[model samples]
Target: MTVDIEPSRAIPAHSWRRWVGLTGLLLAEAMNLLDATITTVAAPVIRADVHGSASSLQWIAATYTLPFAIALIPGGRLGDIHGRRRILLISLAGFLASSTVCAVAPSMAVLLPARAVQGVCAGLLIPQTIGLIKAMFDGAALGRALSLIGPVMGLTAVAGPVLGGVLTSADIAGLSWRVVFLANLPLGLAVLGSIRFLPEDRADRKPSIDVSGALIATAVAAALLVPAIDATIPPWARLALVAVGLIGAAGLAVHMRKTRARGRDPIVEPSLFRDRGFPAALLSSVLYFAVSTGLVFVVVLYVQEGLGASVLVASLTVLPFSLGLAVASLLAGQVLLARTGPKLMLVGVGLLGLGCAGGVVAANLAPAANLAPVPSLSPWLPVSLGLAGIGGGLVTVPFFTAALARVRPHETGSAAGLLNSVQQLGGTAGVAGLGAVYLHHTGTPGGALAIVFGTCLAIALVLAVSATAMLSSPKDVGQP
Candidate 1:
């Protein structure tokens, strides 16, 4: 499973065309990121308009992410076989079509299915960005391009909620929340128009698809994700699903080894795990994202439900965090990372832990809600979140850069897919685990928030310790 760029079609790193192509890839990635959270603020409005059950509302969000996560490995393999440019274009087209359907959907039935299609397309599209970026850029150019990804991600996290609220409130064309889906159209079309600039690259030799391995992998992802997303399921059932996922993971590993033994390409190469840094990077990603995602979830709930703030105000409160993230990402990528190496990640973890401690203090200091129309949040809350975001920015790009550093050129697509899959799983786990902790102490909102932040701080400490041990290995140090 080695990819070779078509010599005639190869775009040079110095060419302006490559930058144009990179823009298209980044936009596509942003669409995927935005959709993941954009619907959160608008979910209530959507449910009311479509006459959807509470369960259906949950399904609306779950359907997109679950399929996206499940299809990632196979999607990356498809790019390896059929060429990244072609797959990206096809997937982008599908995403546009499905998003249109979502905008026009008159019922939950139509909307949920359309959202599922959008997720599948996003899965197929995202890996190609990483694949194409690696294919197109090298040296300092690669670092610069990769640096931009963290900022875009951080900004979009803020944009999703704020944009969703604004669109829904604006009630464009009297469509209300449907406008959120409609918003993807212009961005999608702009990227679509840049198709000609993208380089075509694929495997040197076509390989048979590992049908058994793909199915097993999808099943394992579903088993794990379904439980995490749908809290309505009984505790015993969720545990059973987790057990099934673990067993399936074991079976999938065996199947991949057997498939590779028979001289066929498995969905993921077994040899990738032999890279000690790759596994350590993956572990760090899981820990980092779990805390980050969980912290966001808890903060949003606390601001709105606990503090009795309006949705708009709640969304606005997160703005400082995103701004801090954007600033820190640029600093790390442009200046700090090239000189500091893995040591920078430790600094990030320490800052994040300190921010979490601030969050605990802020939560304890929150004023009790009164009958006033506008509720007041503690000043320290935004400051703490911003500090945490800065830490997140510091780690995000370096983590991706480090994970792929030791990977062979041929393994970029698969490695990118696996890294992304771990991220999604980590986020889901964080939401389920931390959300439960918050819910348990809902009667005491301040106390619940304190507990959540304390938990995040604890996780940050553990991640710092693990990262120290991981980076101490000679193989893992100063690679990028």
Candidate 2:
């Protein structure tokens, strides 16, 4: 039987359907990003309400990201094999159901698992966002559609903490921290309804799923992640877990090579890394995301538990950072990105290091009493975070554009999936790894924060040095 595998015509740029579909996609994108960081501001509240252990707090965030990172490649491949619209709808339904579970969860025990399911659903939905863009538009039209995503992403990141704080503090219907997830129900339904407006595209030649590669990759990620979750664990035991993780990584490399040799598609295209610049770009993406997530998670705790800031106040304290990120990301994507991709990233990374150093210094300057109220330190706190945010925009905006610069049309889904998955993985690792450090030093919040922020600063500087030497020129990234 013949299947409806391709669109008859590109959707017109001015058509109502096109805008509606774009709105749906953007809403979905916003919701996903919002959920990612919204919990940050509410995390302390959630911990108090649930009476959860410090580790549970970390799990609440890390659990969502781990599955998300692991599932993205397969999620993208599924969209290619089936249809973008079909997979997107399925994922959204799962997300809504999972959100409902999260909203009603009576304890941390139930909530963590529900959040994992939500992350998986997010993984499934996110890749289709980019894949649909590729399927719907081409040439300059494609560039225009894609350009809008950066600003939207920045806004969502800026808005997520504020929204979370408002919802949690307002305690809508007296649901408290649960309102964050409950709020998504309406938006989820709206996106589901608008799915009809999105263009549907499927691969003409369906490829076999790389089941073994996926499983092996999961093993690799898990071997490191599971052990890192608990700071109380013995260092010797954690080292063993790291060894197992290394073995799994080696196994994944071997299996992918075998798959390629057998002329079968692997979850990750080994050929993609053959480009010297692509691998460096991918590593830089990982470092950038890890630093961002880790810093946010730690800062939320420091602000609320250490500085005694209310949820709203804590969220507002971080607002300037988001504002800086939004402005810088828009500028980078629009102007600096085309002129000096690597150079701009270097500047961004350098700023990130300096910003992080400033935060570390601010943490040190704060009175170690652990009972100080909001506005504890100088204006330097937010300023430093804002500088870091600008660096974030500079690094990320150009990174995505540069990494996918040379990707072929047929490889679009795979490339987007791999890149996005790495980003999620970086976030997952950051929360898990740095959260451990934060928890281990909880008795002294300032000291813990100083250590974590210091680590971030070091990583940023290292990446800046590496990117300066390794990343390609702006022309190389922008060329077809």
Candidate 3:
């Protein structure tokens, strides 16, 4: 009935109960992480089997992310308005059921609907994981808890490719690509056992669900995202999609203005953006991931084409990056929140820029032919990735830490939603813009990839400068 999370306490002296809660939350978060990612690898397989046009395949993937992205803020608000434990449990159950539907889907028609439902469930669970962490831990201990989050994200980011390859290759149950969807089942069930032991969190004051604001937001996001994912459409169709998004955005703005005129709570508060740090961090994330995710795409091509490695070999080579992140993410989180805060982010972003540039140089020079045995070009990719681990960890881990400190208590849901939306938008744009850059210059694919990343490196340097500007003068990062 009521959900007011007690500020998170310190990580309990190592204990089974504390560990169980941590694991449960991690598994829950992974379901979202793995699902968002793994399906992309499976998309081509589904297209081959389901006999859909390329657009349908895109829809199958976009339907999930679009809804999930559109729904995240509202989902977090729902948990706050109701109860996170109840919502989390319900979200997990719904997600599992949807996974089964996707597993058993006979055609694109059946599968796409299931993906949308699954995304909605993910939107519900993902933010609640952060909310639960907020509820359960505080101060330095909270930093530790937040730090643990990055590793699961890191694991899934790397594991998605390797795991998808294995499932597609094995086809042990004859499920082929569908095995990826079905994989969520065990992870879902496992979370149930752990969630049973999770402490319940209910807000003391429930806010009214802003249905109008939610509908508007969804329309705006889907309008923009749906078109971006469907690349084969005519130029006019593409323009139409952009127009639709602009109109939807306008409608949402007008609605919010009306709500504000009447003194009701708008889903996205204008005041939240007024803070210097909020815009600074948000813009930084947009530019950073735009380059970072694009780097992954380019590196995949560079290793296979420029370096002349097999797909399997190229995929496996990326492991060092994740392994590096798993090692350093939490430590970086501790350093950011405890010692440096904004200054830490500036350093992290700076390293990311340098590593990306160096990695580019390395990839160009170091080919598999140069290294012995397995062969590797530019061994710097892994080292670059390792350095990125610190940068990525610092930029992200402090996000929630800073959000909680700065946002009005009631707007945490919106804050979380905004965070997810920007993060996803950045990734989506990176894939599109960078992928386009690579494709448009297919005759010189390696050059295309490098150029895209080189551009991103410059942008990242600019972001680092912005962080320095915002965090130093105003003390806007820690103080509300």
Candidate 4:
């Protein structure tokens, strides 16, 4: 039987506290979203200033993602065991600290480690933002609250580039690229303020961390990501990385199996997978991100290198994706509420695939070793990315909503932990796998991009098929 959560019958006297909690949630969500893209616009400036290595450049991106990926489950599990609100407060405080460290770092070594710390803080805050929503609001109120998060995230994506560009150009207080990280300080403090005044949730018996499980999961993801990244290094290293990744995954599975038999909570419980729909949705998500993340990274490189655009100009040019995502997200929620979500998903995926196809076009038509960038191709670039944004907007919330619906009410926290872990894994894997494919194929300005985007199109098509199979037919969708 399905359990539909309903709102409290009496309007609480603590409405102010509830709003405070909501604000905190929003603030935390914004930080996580901002971190994801803020670096995209800052990378060029960072490269020039640091005289960084290729590995360092990749770490600038990967450090944040890897820790975020590994720690999400543990972080979510902590929120469930301890107080989510308390964890949120701690994370906000840590985020503030990490942001400051990032702002002052003199070397790539210092900066990348600081960014990893920031990612850990983010892992704590982001999942709890949603968990607290589930704890604080229910039924129709829950629906409204979930709907509120997307537009805010969409806005952040739009701001990431613009804000990053503005900071790099302005160099006020001699900050330069530091502004990207420093900007988080005030926002985090604001969230911390809200947490102090907000409602909170706690499990009476806080569970201990599943250290063995965590080690295994971390090892597996690192092994997989490291190998894909260093694919061209050596035959022996490639084989070793793959073997290690598989062993790590196998170890985690065994550890979790033992944890389940021990009658204690594991970081990622196998029970979450019993619903069947959850794994399928997860598989589709992994495929979807293979295109989305790879496209974003590659396209940014293309616009900057091929077009000879300044940091600000490049960011502005890429604005279409964020804008389209925001617009699509706002509209898709309302459409999905009426039983038409499947159609919108199809349309969104179609648009997204078309957008990836456009990237292929952009790459092929790029000026060849020319003195000037082709002005003609530049204008259409955003249009192509914007299409994917629209599709992304439609898919994100509904997919999460659908996935969460498949779990039992008591298990929401566990489900949240698991799903976020998988989401980050897909993102990390996308960059590693598709990125390697790109680097292997071409050495020109847009060469890596053309190959990466083609891979993206193929991945998108696979996701489209999966989404259609699951959502188009009544039999596959079942209840959730």
Best by lDDT: 2
Error of 3 at 82 (Å): 3.8
What's the TM-score of each model vs. the native? 0.88, 0.93, 0.81, 0.89
* Candidate 2, superposed: residue stretches over 4 Å from native: 1-14, 370-375, 406-412, 472-480
Question: Against the unseen true structure, what C-alpha lDDT does each candidate score?
Answer: 0.79, 0.80, 0.68, 0.71
Regions more than 4 Å wrong, model 3: 1-22, 40-61, 104-110, 130-151, 166-171, 198-201, 301-311, 334-339, 362-390, 399-405, 408-410, 469-473, 476-480
Number of backbone clashes in candidate 3: 14
Instruction: List runs of model 4 lying over 4 Å from the truth.
Output: 1-14, 134-142, 230-232, 336-339, 369-378, 439-443, 469-480
Residues 1-480, model 1: lDDT tens digits: 355555565677569999998998999999988997787667656877899864554466667876777667787678878899999999999999999999999999899999999988998898788778878887798888986777778778767877876788788889888889999999999999888888888766676778798789878877876775565789999999999999999999999999989998888878777766677777887788788866776676677667776556666777676676778888997899999995788888888898999999998898756334457778899999999989888877577766776777757656777888788767656765676678667457878998999999999988887677556545633233
**Which stretch of 10 consecutive residues in model 4 shows the poorest summed lDDT?**
1-10
Which stretch of 10 consecutive residues in model 2 shows the poorest summed lDDT?
A: 1-10
Model 2's lDDT to the true fold? 0.80
Considering lDDT, which of the candidate structures 1 and 2 is the better prediction for this target?
Answer: 2
Please tell me which model should have the higher TM-score, number 2 or number 3.
2
Flag clash pairs in model 4.
Answer: none
lDDT score, candidate 1, position 10: 62
